[model samples]
Target: MSQAAPGKSHREGISLIELTEMFPDEASATAWFEQMVWPKGKRHCPRCGCTETRKASATSGLPYYCSGCKRAFSVRIGTALERSKVPLRKWVFAIYLEMTSLKGVSSMKLHRDLKVTQKTAWFMLHRIREAWSTESASLFNGPVEVDEMYVGGRRKNMSNAKRRELKDTGRGAVGKVAVVGAKDRATKQVKAKVVESTDRATLHGFVADAAAPGATVYTDEAVAYEGMPFPHETVKHSVSEYVRDMAHTNGIESLWSMFKRAYNGTYHHLSEKHLNRYIAEYAGKHNLRNFDTINQMAAVAAGMVGKRLMYRDLIA
Candidate 1:
């Protein structure tokens, strides 16, 4: 995005005056980030954790030189935006656009809204998606539902010849990626992973890892998951039965609808390589749909440090 006039703020859920007060100028934003990122007074070198450091004379204003490691770094040094020449304001605006849009703001849309070239907009959004790729250790704390769905192609839509060629659903799912989902019903939180296969060994293992032991897990009567070992229950779909005394895969299934809608409505296409980051964005947003938008923005921005993504890598 073209840098905005000074004093503008893109933060959501707060008044213009409030956000403006928070980030009145470039200096203030820098200070705000420094405090937020290293509140404990230890600026561990991004390249190496060296306790002793001083500002590098080669750079102006607040860059640190780690004496122990002979490295210079700043708050953005190891973040997704580390080497990016785009201003911090664009990063803030880009994240605001990503978090606030339900379906998603396309790169084209972000290009229009942020007044940046499409290439810059695309890279920026992908980097923001990187932050959304959370390694949250928060296991599903309540009743978790696990299921798998074929994400691509309707058998009815494919050409008969092409469908015939791709009919074998074995040895790497040659056409479609097997997706596993776990949804916590009470919290309405969902987590999904792009898995290699949907075999019993693959799907069940992912479910157990994401959800705690003894959790009441529910799913459909997929023969692939007949003998699940964790307080398991199933609702057979073949007998015209979808639910029995509140047993169903509806929660995780709803997540699939939302995920597909976002991909179709905004992103238009998704590759198997980038699907997990996209899933992380949707699941994180869905899990906290009830919370204030600014809090979600903070959570995303707070994760920007200590990780890096090159513009080339995003495309590759």
Candidate 2:
């Protein structure tokens, strides 16, 4: 197994040895969790933040007592993995697979790799995605790239007449949801949302929400962006020059490529109902693509604090 030292090369990603080394057993993972969760070592009460604590017993697993709360609780009490039946090792390992992969990993494929049932793998993937979801700051600053992509359709799914219509009309992102994104080139962070139309309201609202005041936005010559109030630069694809003076949608363009490939290659069909959750899932991974997969995993575990995703809500 590999040991991932801090400040490792981002391009190298996770080494196979490092993945294996993460868990010699469930105990190894538990120890690792203790290290992360209690780095300051005070182990304060999650409920009241009281410093007083007591151990249940060495023989009994999950032995933590909080004096302020005057109750016993386990480490999984407030995490996404809370009340989960899966082992911590499996949970952490699943996160590792999700974070390290370039495009993404599918639940079906994860079922094969992790030796879990497909249903379990699917549930696990969704839960892990919830961990990566961001809840801090309001938007990005500086130059932003905005573009739209068509996600759903098949070449042969369309009737011959419809196909001809599409061909004649030109591929203008027809019959697809308009996904708009803002990419901050300097920070390499991106935020994307699935919108209803390429209409001015949708495009402009998304851009305004994602970027800060006076920030420049970059986009292609899409009519949807007509009369935008914010300052933006456009490149004409028809003219065959994509980049002019270091301004282009290449960063966000690259994001679209990987996102589409991951969706097409894995899962295969994405239902429109829960598309936004999947959007948040991929966006979290892409936005944090620069961080350590393990560190990112740790952050997600930490973030699961005070949040809840009920199974009923998930099914609904």
Candidate 3:
């Protein structure tokens, strides 16, 4: 309900009053989602990809019927919202909160805000994150900054047995997962992934996939980045050299810093099995940070198409 601070010139987001006025009810929210998902003003069949459809009977939960598929479907049928019982109004508000919150919104907070169970809120967040799994078609043009970071609970916070087990294997990054990312200096967009290891092939392959041909790359003095195909430069962090004539990986490191803040401050624990999804969510949010709040929310909705994450599969 709070408004922006005094004397701020730029518009970052809308007021709660505006949000409520825009989506005052489930019907309004559903219409807005329909507009974003089916911009042509007509619903298409997800199964048969047919545009010929009719309204369903009032008693049926499905809102549309496709003659080609002979099936009843709702706007949620093929997207991350498919089979979800939560109201569209709540989904709209959830996407709004997720995009606006700088650190991130926790499921517990979302549960209180939406009046839903904590378990349901947790699943809802994961599904919403599922909607952020958009992959960029074009590669980043240089000079791109690349870096890798380890994500997990700190070593001192681990249990005695776990600490000993990790010590037996190795010291740093022994039990943590490695996440490598890149930031395009030209477009200011970012890309990242959670990898099994930070080996030469893994790191180099990630940079190669993300950077365009003939683009210049900047990285730390990690030996894995020594033989990049593109024009490569490194800053020797081991000797406290961070930035040396536009050769620093600071841009990508800043992206990792934001992700770590969200990790440590909001979602305290991120399992390795689901780490990639979380990384994708952060990268997507970072990539779209400059857009208007409503457009960012609409992008999440648009990306929801052809994507669905079931609770069973998520847990499995």
Top TM-score prediction, candidate number: 3
TM-score of each: 0.83, 0.86, 0.93
Best by lDDT: 3
> What tens-digit string does per-residue lDDT give for candidate 1 at 1-316?
1222222144236554565676667676666566556766666777777767777876554478878777677878777878777767666667777877778888899899768999999888888877667656777766888887666655566687767676664323446667888898876778887888888888778877888877888888887777776787889887977888868988898888987888778876777778888887788777656555566666677777666788777777
Mind giving the per-residue lDDT tens digits that candidate 2 earns over 116-184? 998888878878777655634677786888888777867677778878878999874666666777788
The number of clashing residue pairs in model 3 is 0
> Which of the predicted structures, 1 or 2, would earn the higher lDDT when compared with the native?
2
Of the candidates numbered 1 and 3, which has the greater lDDT value? 3
TM-score of 2: 0.86
Q: Give a tens-digit lDDT track for model 3, residues 71-109.
A: 898889889999899999999999999998878899999
Better of 2 and 3 by lDDT: 3
Per-residue error at 214 for model 3, in Å? 1.1
Question: What's model 1's overall lDDT?
Answer: 0.74
In order, the Cα lDDT scores of the candidates are 0.74, 0.74, 0.87
Worst 10 residues of 2 by lDDT: 1-10
